[model samples]
Every structure is written in structure tokens, then in C-alpha cells.
Target: MKRSAAAFFVSVAVLAAGNGVRADGPDEHAGRAQEYILANDFDEARKELARGKPDDVGIATERARLALYEADCDGALVTLSSPDVAKTEQGAMLADIARGCARVTAANVLEEDHDQGVWIRYQDENDRALTPLIIETVVKAREALTRDLGATWPKPTRIVVVRDLLSLSAMTGLPYESAQTTGTVAVAKWGRVTLLSPRASIHGYSWRDTVAHELTHLAVTRATVDRAPLWLQEGVAKREEVRWREPGPFDDRPSPDAIAARGIELKLDLPLDKLGPSIAMLPSADAALVAFSEVASFVRFFASSTPPGSLERLFAALRDGKEPDSALEIASSGNLKQWDTKWRAYLQSKPKEPLPPLLSLGKEPAPNPKAPSLREVRERMRLAELLLARKHPTEALSELERLQLVGAAGAPQDDPSYRYLRGRVLMALADPGRTKEAEVLFQDPKEVLSSYGPWWALRGVLARSRNDEAIAEPSFAEAVATDPFDVEAACETLDADSPTPPSKDPSPLCQSARAWKVPSGTED
Candidate 1:
């Protein structure tokens, strides 16, 4: 979790004293206002501030806090720049943070949507297609977390989707380098959730799941009144990220226990209590994934073995200022250390999955001795895509064949992009033999899931051709969910010969996709 801005209430109080502005004297209005702000009762906090002298230190700081809490960086800056508040050391620090946030959010706010207590912010017109998915995830998450964790929200959740890691850093105050290191795409901090746009990734990420995961952090903070420790916070968030959705292929593919078991076998797991401030600050993506899996598995174990309301009781204890270990003991009816031991033993019994490759994001390709070979591979892939786009499927096929040979030196055999492009080229050729080859390429559901969009769309098309409705529907849905910006995926229908299905409302993704310009012969 990103740290909250430094507490400026004390400094503001001192500054107020120097100005002979009495705030806590007879009515104690400022004191009560600060208490309300700390409890996240911004409305009540504002009321209390109204009751106090406008220029009172307590009133100004709490008002500023309320503005920051709502992600009103401009409003915060105005409050902090007040003559009395500006002189305080903490106020100056907070002003700097607000300025950074203002710079980052200014562009994203150009486009915005909100409903069902969720606000979505993004910059590009193309990303408008993603608003529905984000809103659906958050709405479901709110209901699920409230039912499971007894979490409540006093304000509408704000979500900002940025185009890059740099904006994510500026908005959240996490260093840009830290985000690149751990492949951190989203963070729930300050007062809102901020995430990287799926379009920014080389291959699209599980952006819907990511939004739910980050929102869970906000729910945890709300439930614990911001007192939950790092381990408890992360563990609970990971455990609940998938709770909003029905059981499906997309649900924690490797499973947390399996990943955690692998991490243990590889000696890559971090101690739950020792995971520093945020997993995003970990040295590498491998370390971050291991840490996430361990905490997620441990929390699942902890939640299951304990009584029905054990997690709620734990949240209550944390809110009441109990230490995390003591809170665990009270909720679980066992010592914290004993609970950890049992969880570890349980994890050992689960089937282990091999550790997946470490992910890299928002960074240039690392220096390689065989740079020319890598460049050739990239060039061939680019030329193949251009060739396929320009109705030169035969040429595209030749380029892909060369790419396959190049892979012999040292490239992944199952590179999803390679398989997806080759399949598309083969389909465009419309030869029975090549079409059969395309079908074979997309037969692996795991491989299809790993690709950005085209593979899933191709899978859907092939399945539809064979009248396999089961695979076609889900594959097309997954394709749209994976990369809605892709015109073909978004516009693809499960049954091309059938009339458009009637609906109370059409899908935003489809609407956006249909309106987008399609390259010639994209679906052939």
C-alpha cells in the first residue's frame, strides 16, 4: 500500500498558535473535526470544520485532508497554500505530493465515467471501451467484500487508469523504478485506486482482476480503519480479488497455494511479516509474485480454519487498536505462530506448480550479447504483421516460416504472439491444409489464454466454424476482455450467419469496436 501523506495537523496547530489563532479553546471544534477526518467521515469532518473558525489550523488541515482523500489534488493545493499552513514543514511536503498528483491526474480526467458508487478516469478515446469492465468489477467487488469481510465504503471509489508507469508513480508517490521492477500495474493508495492502462502493456494484463485486487486494498483499509498491518492487508486483498467472479478458467490459473508451494520449493518466498511496506517495492517480479502467493495462501488457510466471522472479528480487533498478532489469536483461537505453522504445513500438502517466468513491464529489453538475433526476430514479427494487414498472406507466411527458423537459435517454442500471427496468416490463406494448421495452433487453450487478443479471436472463429458454441462464446468474450482495442476481437460474433442478438443494452466494448475503423479483410 502507498503511504498516506505526512500528518500536518500537528504542524498546522503550531503555526496557528504562532498566529494567535485559537482553535481548540472553548468549543474544541477543530479537535472534533480532526477526529472525524481520521475516521474517514469527510462529510462530518466538513461540518465540524464549518463550526470552527475558518482560518483555524485544525480546520484548514482537516479540510485539506478531506480534499486529498477525495483525490482533489487542486483543492488540496489551494488549502495547503494558505499563508499559515504553507509555512509548516509537513504542509510543504504535502504540497509537493499534491502538485505531483495534480500533474498526473490532469490529463486523465479529460474522460470520466461513474455509476454504482464507482468512478472511472482515463485519457484516450479508445480506452472508453474499458469503462464498463472496470465498473462491473468494482460494483461486484463492493458487494462481495462487504458480505465476506464486513467492509463498508463512506465515499464513491475513484479509479484512475493511466497510460504508463510514470503516471502511476506520480499519482501514488511510489517511485517509477519500483513499479517497473515488480511489474506493479495498479496501486490503491492515498484515497483512490490507480492502474496502468492495458494498452500500455506489451501483452495485455488481467486488468479486471487487477482493479478488483486494488479495490480490495481500499476495502481492507476501510474495514480496519487503516490499522491493518501489511501482511494482513495484502493477504486479504489477494484472497478476495477473485471472490467477485464466478468460477472460471480465468480464476487464479496456477492457484495461490500451488504458486506458494513452488515458491517454498525454490526458496523464493518472503516471510509474511517481513514483506516491507509494499510488494511493489520488492527487488524483482519473481520476489513480488512469491510474496503475493505466500500471503494469499496463508490468508486463505487462516480464513477457512477459523470460525465464520473470524475475519470480521479480526478486522474489528484491528479497528480497536489491537496488535496484528493479538488480533489473530483473538479471531482464530490459536497463537499467531501456531497458525502460521499450520498454514505452512497445509501449503506443503497442496500440489505445486512450477514457478512461471518473471515478468518485465515498462522497461526496454535488457542488454543481450545476441542483440542482432533478437532484433531480427522483432523485425520479422513486425514485417509479418504488416504483410498480413496489407493482404499479403503468402508473404506473411514466408516471414513466419523464417521466424520459426530464427527461434531455433534460442526463442520460446510456444511464443503466443508467434502462434497467433501464424494462425492468422494461415486463416487468411484459406487453404484447407493451412486452415487445419491454424486450428491445430489454437487447440491449446493455455496458449490462447496467454496471447493478447488475436489468438482468442482466432480460436473463437475456428470454434464457430465447427459449430462448437461452447468454446466460441467464451473465446470471443475472453478476446474482448483481453484486448478490447483490437477491432476484430471486439467485433467478432459467435455466429456470423445469425442476426444480432437482442439485448436490453449492447456491450460498450462492441459498440466501441464496431465504431472503430477496421483494417481491410481483417476477419478473412
Candidate 2:
């Protein structure tokens, strides 16, 4: 929930700083493009490339990276296949994906809640089963975050469910494995979330808690206008992941003993102000772990020792444009310098206990591949998407049609991509007579698919093709707003040019689409 993918990934992308570039340089367009990409402004990153240095290997690599960001492996392959790209370090990494993902049959994207958040993901079997858990988590998170922060999120957030670590990594440019490892269950950045599915937890992380943790990050990010210190952001999110009442049974969370033991290494840590940026830039996993533990512990201390509304006021001060040090002074009558002294004294009073190895609080190690994982469905779907992209929709349909017989058993007939391809093949072949049937596929987008902005954008395209302005207008609007970076959604929304009535009297069709849900999330 807490990590800014931009911060983490841009750092990872910096590894292959091209021939002339070793890191971001404002003087170079390549460096500026990296900055834009890090900020999650892919459109601007492209603009930077267009302005100059379009041939820079580093910049070219970032451009290919953008295609993967949208889960278009084939598109990325085309970008990186060139001789120039093959010579760069990043091109090697991007090539691995483009090569592997060419066999993919399905694809990615998502849609909205009633002013709550958007449910987003690629087309896969888990979509239905994962919907309710995600919706429940987001609703509770929004309510909880609003109460805790005494503020509301400035914009609606997208809750993206990733099918694999690679897709998530590509989107964020953070390495989930390899050298720059982040034991990230989920990340909240640019007012959105990207996470693994329910069973994708690494270590002993609770999936629900992780979702809540990320949503809290989004809320805090908005509250502080992304100006809050890293310590405060991470600490508050870790603490607030659970609704506080009294200390209860271990959910295998970091215990007081574990945290205190971890903190022992930080005996001479920097004062809070100086500590802020260091935590984010720590070079090793061990350092990252210690930073997380110490900050979580300090936040617990600050919340407990402070007056009733002090923490709340602290956030308010930051929101109202106070500097970090000034905000702390105004909120606590002491800045980090004083707080660090108090926290150190508080730590000294704690009793020591034997510390165990850091492991998950759960019985399972990593999830055993006991039964079918998502790989099969995702691969088949990706394959179909690849075929469609190649302008062979009929061939794509042949692949999708075969896909329907096996892996899609529990899947709803209304599944967006499956149904989407049905209509697309019909349209691609110019079969106007069966267009009515194609229209049916986009009609009732299931809850699992509803939050998927691409399907809605697809629906908009389908509707607009037949001059069905009634459906096209709202569907496109919903899609664009749900996933701002979705190229198709953004384009179609503009093309539809849906009337914008006064905010009070909004379109009913759009309202229904925003609140759309599936009939039943389970087989029973």
C-alpha cells in the first residue's frame, strides 16, 4: 500500500542508464523521460522523447517499457526488436518479457465503484472470485482512511489486481525479484494500487490487510499532497492497516518482540528529519527491513504518548501547506529533533526478548502449486489478444473459442475478453448481421469485469460503432476516468464527447455502470 512505484521503479530503471547516461540528468532528454516515467506520466515521457533524443538507447528502452506498462507484450516486442534496442541493458529485460508474453491469449484493464474506487485487472479466471473481497476491502478502507485522516481522497483511486509479479513489476518498473528486490505485496502510487491476487502473498502477509494498507497510503498521499515524509507515510500505514481496539491475538504480524529486536540494530539511527530520505534510499534488504520496523515502532510510540487529536492535527498541518519540520512543531510542539530524543528514551525502557528469524506469521512458506494456478488462463487469453493485435480476429476467436472449453468452466459467459473477442471477430470480419449478437457481449459487464475499464471502453467502442450514443457516452466516460493511462479508454472517451450535464444531474446510464456488480461471486 505504501510504496510509490515511481520512486522504486525509476530507481530500478536507472540501472541501465544507457551508454552516455548512468543516471537521470536534467540536461539530457533521456533523463527527463525517465523522470516523467517515474512520475507515472507516460504521456509526458513520450513528449520528452518527441522533443529530442528520440534515438537515445535509454529513452528508447523507456518507450518500450511503456508498452509493457499497459500489458501489451507484442507491442513492446515490436519496440524492442529493433537493433538499437537489442544493444541496451534494459532491452534485454524487456526482451525476456516480449519473448515470453507473445504466447499470451488474453489482456489487462478495469472500471468504477459508486464514487469509491475502481476495480481493475486483466482478463482471467480469478476475476469473479476476487471481486467481492476487493470491493469489501476498498469500501472498508475508504471509510477507515477517511475517519483516521479526517480527510477524503482528492480523486477516485484505481485498485488494480495483478495476475503475476512480472506484470506488476513491469507496470511499476520495480524488481520484485533479482537484485533490487521489494517484498511488496502491493503498492499504492499515483493515486492507484497494483497488487497480487488473494493467494499471491509472499512471506506471511495478510491479503486483506495489505489492501487496506495500500488504500491508506492513497488517502495519506492526497492528504499531504504527496509531501509527507516517508517515515510518517509508512509508519502510519503499517499501524492503521488494522482497525485499532485493543492488542489482540497474533495474526502473525510483526510482534512487539520482533519489532523491538529489529530496532536494536538502529541504536544510532538518524534523527527523524534526516531519517526520512535515507529509509527510501537504503541499498540493501536488511537496511529496508530495519527501517520499516523502527518507523512502525516509533509511530506506535508517537500515537500512544501524544494527546487525543495530535496525530490528526499533524496530518492536517501538512495538508494545509506546512513544511515537515514546521508541521511537526505545530502538531506536537516539538519537531523531529525533540521527538527523536523522546523516542530513544522510550525505547530504552522496553524489556529485551530473544528475537527469532524474520519469517511469515503463517504456516505456509510460499504457496505450493497444488492445483491450477492462473498461468494457464492468462496464457490462453494473452494468445488471443496477440492474435487480435495482429489483425487476425478470426484466428484470435479460434484460440478464444478453444479457451472456453476447458479453463473457463467457472467463468461467467459474460466474461469481457471472451465475449469481447466474439464481437470483435464479428466486427473485424465485417459481419453486420451478427453485430446484434456482438452487442450482447458488452451489454451486462459483470462485477468482475465492470471495474475493468478496458471492457467498458470496449463496450463504448462497440456501442458507438452502431450509433448507440445512449450506451457509448457513459461507458466511455467510466472507462477513461477509471484508468487514466488506458490509451483506448482515453481516446474513446474523447471521441464519444459525451455530454456533460451539471454535476448534480449526471447521466443515469453512467451511474449504473459505475455501480455495476456481478450476480454471484461464488459457484455455490
lDDT of 1 by residue, 85-159 (tens): 777654665676688788877766443443477777775556777877777788888889889987777657788
Model 1 clash pairs are none
- Against the reference, the lDDT scores of all candidates come to 0.67, 0.54
Q: List model 2 lDDT by residue over 1-524, tens digit each.
A: 11222221111111111111222223377666654544345677778778766566766776776565444568888888888778766687678756654442245444456656454554344333445546766777777776766746433456666656665555444454632343455666533566655333211124556677777666666565455777787777767776522232232233433554545554424445554333434554444555566667778888888887777788778767688789989888888878877887777766754332213211122332442234555556667666766678778777656644323332235444456546666666667776776677777644222234566777888887777889887776556433322334545632233543233243333333233322211211
Alpha-carbon RMSD to native, per candidate: 8.2, 17.3
Model 2 misplacement above 4 A = 1-106, 109-111, 115-117, 176-180, 201-204, 244-248, 251-258, 265-284, 357-524
Model 2 weakest 10-residue run by lDDT: 10-19
Which 10 consecutive residues of model 1 have the lowest summed lDDT? 8-17
lDDT of 1: 0.67
lDDT of 2 at 12: 16
